[model samples]
Target: MSGDPLERIAAALERLAPGPAAAPDWDAASAFVWDAHPDALHPVPEVSRVPLGLLVGIDRQRDTLLANTRRFAEGLPANNALLWGARGMGKSSLVKAVHAELEATGLKLVELQREDIGTVGRLLALLRGAPHRFVLYCDDLSFSHDDAAYKSLKAVLDGGATGRPANVVFYATSNRRHLMPRDMIENERGSAINPAEAVEEKVSLSDRFGLWLGFHACDQDGYLAMIRGYCAAHGLDVDDAALRAEAIEWQATRGARSGRVAWQFFTDLAGRHGVRI
Candidate 1:
């Protein structure tokens, strides 16, 4: 209190500011969410996810991602993965399910938000020499006009000078295969003096991911299988014929047939029966 007013004000400001984040307790949890502001990894003890067996549709996608993840976990050479395709077809779910399925092998999943792409380099540096292998996940990843954050992400994935750590691999889920709208790439093509190179630079971001597993929309049988799987797992006790009829009616009302819709219908059915899933 006796100090000069300016000095005292500065001291107060410093105290009010956040301190450097604590080093992550990597062993504390199987999953983590990377917080870039304070620069810390937050543990996720209970991940919100469905069991891999319950995922129902997209068997091929499920297998491909699992294989690549397994290779990475075993310290074998593995490609960064891009899970792209129809919405709610389990792109993000597959990533989480795969991590959960393989967590016993010391594979850790770290979710980095799309907005935090610029800070990925810092996160990679932290994970570079760690004993454990990490799958850096970004769900719903995409880029818009003039957003340069993707450059840092590209550098980290492609491994600029140091190269990506053998212990770390990146996985992302996106509705767009290129993580950019077709129009966005076309716009670059329309404006650039050299259209091919301009477009190549933008679309090549996806190329960094060696595994481009696409999850397409499921068919009627696929959708029904999803609903039946959930019903059986949760003990809904509904007859097969009745279940199919209700599920079909539900999809008709909603005008869609995907895993998400199946789950939504199951939720309603459970609610009516007073069964908590």
Candidate 2:
């Protein structure tokens, strides 16, 4: 034990400060969830994601993201992608599905929560030198009016000094196209002396993403197709007429029709029919 007061104080400070995070075992799993408190990547042995073929609507988004992810995995040029638009349109699902399809290419998926946006630089530093390529995913990403975490996100997307590691590509899903609420942008425009620049400062964060894919609300036909696809995949036998009537009634009850709503309906139908999905 140190007898000197200065040495004792230094020891206490060192103990309080978190130690450098340990390097993760790259071969542990295909997907991981970043835990910011302890600064660790927890392996996800089984990622809950639907098959690429089963995603009925949004074929255009499916193809584009697949191609982009493929390029990144192959060590070719690729862009950080932002999947933004309507709720329950499978923005986050697509990210996972694409990564699953390309997992054989030595590509990995690391989920970064929206709350941990500030620790992205530290996360990046850990992944910078890893051998496997990573798709850094953040689901339902959005920023509030007073939040400054967006600046940290900019650093990841813009890659300030040490450019984003060659092995890492960022992919985020959000309901907001600009990653901020419309009211927040309008607030900035109303208050700032230079309205354009003020709005631009916040909106420009989205411009950092090279690929901006938008997912809109699925049409009735598209919604029905999603249900049919799920039924077929699980081999749940139901008459088309009955299925249509029941599914329509279900949608009516929910007051919305989306891939998610369709799945919810199918889940109930499957349970009734004793079919496991």
Candidate 3:
């Protein structure tokens, strides 16, 4: 018997439409990276993160984030958080570290890349009914001029119809406090028919995050503290005078002082001492 061509064509088209992703095996891994293509959560068996104590110079931020996360892990109310400020000041590091610190409480970390943000609604749907608590993290998140993705993000964060899942919290790190370039903000101000409205529309996205933690460029003392913390954590022993002198030289050559630089210097120091960190 000859089959109808249209029937076969319809079957092929149905196959082309993406199917619902498999329910994630939350117990398989402590961390995941959301994949939007086929709408799946890829397990991350090993998450690279520093010990919470090894993170120095941002003690105040550390305490605040830890408290918020702890409250959420315990099934209490907690607001979405935005970690904004200086580059390499440990904003992203803190998110991972805090997740690691709270892993014992069954908190899970899902790193959603900025590119996959458009799929946030789907991701939330996948996570909504799960027994686990999740931290949806995005690193170096920012919106450039002509980028419309932020609108979707703003909507999801604002908890439009579906609302954010009670078991899930969001934590994002951005170099820009407003998550937009200064030039972009200025351009909107210069060209918009309603200047104040235009500016507010772009800037208000950050308001969705109830908590804003600002990370600043570390001072010399803060940087030194980071270096020493790394040394102590890794069992690297060096004379204080020599270590400080070399650290100063490293900062001078790099023309910056931050936890990242201190860590880089520590790596070199460890290498020189024939120790692995």
> TM-score: which candidate is best?
2
Better of 2 and 3 by lDDT: 2
**TM-score to native of every candidate shown:** 0.91, 0.96, 0.94
Off by over 4 Å in 3: 1-12
Please estimate how well model 2 matches the true structure, expressed as its whole-model Cα lDDT. 0.91
RMSD of model 3 against the true structure: 2.0
Model 3 vs. true fold: TM: 0.94
Please give the CA lDDT of all the candidate structures.
0.88, 0.91, 0.90
TM-score of candidate 1 against the unseen true structure: 0.91
Better of 1 and 3 by TM-score: 3
Position 238, candidate 2: lDDT:
92
Model 2 weakest 10-residue run by lDDT = 154-163
- Give one digit per residue, the lDDT tens place, for model 2 in 121-167: 98998898787899999999999989999988977786478778888
**lDDT-based ranking, best first?**
2, 3, 1
* Per-residue accuracy of model 3 over 1-277 as CA lDDT, tens digit each: 4689999889889999888777788899999999999899999999988999988888889999999999999999998999999988999999999999899999999999999888888888888878899999999999888888887786457546877888989999999899998999898899999989988977888988999999999899999999998988889889999999999999999999988898899989999999986
Candidate 2 similarity to native, TM-score = 0.96
